[model samples]
Target: METNHINQSPIDLESLISGLKTEDARNLKLMLNIQSMMWGIAAVYVFISALKFIMTTSWYDKLGGFLTLVAFVAFALLFRSYYKEYKTIDYGIPTIEMLKKAAIRYELFQWRGLYVLAPLLLEGIGLNLMMFDDFTNLEPLNRILFFQISYFFVMVIAFLVGYIIWKKRQKPLRDYALALLKEFQS
Candidate 1:
């Protein structure tokens, strides 16, 4: 059985801030690591796509190769931005103004990161379409409809996954920011 300790003293703001800051620092480190892994994953994906394009004679294949590179680079830049923002967040002791700034930037990061995922998903779909010759047989109207439906579906899925990831990182950072802000205000 789990024993619960009941009546306790008031919340210790200093201790709470310290604990939140510690968690934020840990989560920030994990985000940096995730960013590094993404770079490798993007590199490998681009390399494989390049090889596939080189082996194919179709003009569509060449276009797919170019799209792959563009897509990876774009997402990589977004991940890099997240890394840079976290690196500069001043996770150490901060003044009230600093916490305010960090809070705004963290919120901005969450929104921008979410938007980036949809485009990345779209680019992947575009490249896949180029590689598949089945689409060539479809009429222009049908092709457009097919792409529209697929893009919308893929983007919705990507946004949901991206939002979860952003929240995982954002929550800890936001908590730390709020704790600091509250302490400063008090």
Candidate 2:
């Protein structure tokens, strides 16, 4: 075959990208869908719990419940947006564009992660408010210590679980997308 040095043929990107839209893609879509559903369920649960708290006469309880309700609802919306992003992925689009979207969407950490962090901070504040009236028998210092210790442990456990999930699931998919993007770009 003569090398057409002057009129080189364009790269056949379709064949190269065809493999990417298969198993991992399906799994990622499924994962996002499940995550969205779980968040929706969590939002509902929090909403119900908030309603219970709101029914009480205590102002602290009502405020705490409101914050918690807002946090969980935000979480549900955030995850839903993630699922919506997945839905927007068009395989028919250019491979590079598709990969770029996948890479950004699958990244465990990004500017958009602030959306997750904000709700978490709100939840923490709400929990503290809700629990402040509890364990009143303990000394003030002891109560503070108890709340801090328990909250720290719970947050640590939650962070570890989230990190594990990202590492096990999203990281690999993001890495794969980045690899393909890099390969094609170079």
> Which candidate leads in lDDT?
2
User: Whole-model Cα lDDT per candidate?
Assistant: 0.72, 0.79
TM-score of each: 0.55, 0.65
Which residue pairs in model 1 clash with each other? none
- Candidate 2 wrongly placed segments (more than 4 Å): 1-57
Candidate 1 deviant stretches above 4 angstroms: 1-47, 92-94, 108-125, 128-132, 161-186
Candidate with the greatest TM-score versus the true structure: 2
Candidate 1 local Cα displacement, residue 23, angstroms: 13
Clashes per model (N, Cα, C within 3 A)? 0, 0
RMSD of 1: 9.1
lDDT of 1 at 73: 74
Backbone clashes in candidate 1 total 0
Clashing residue pairs, backbone N/CA/C < 3 A, model 2: none
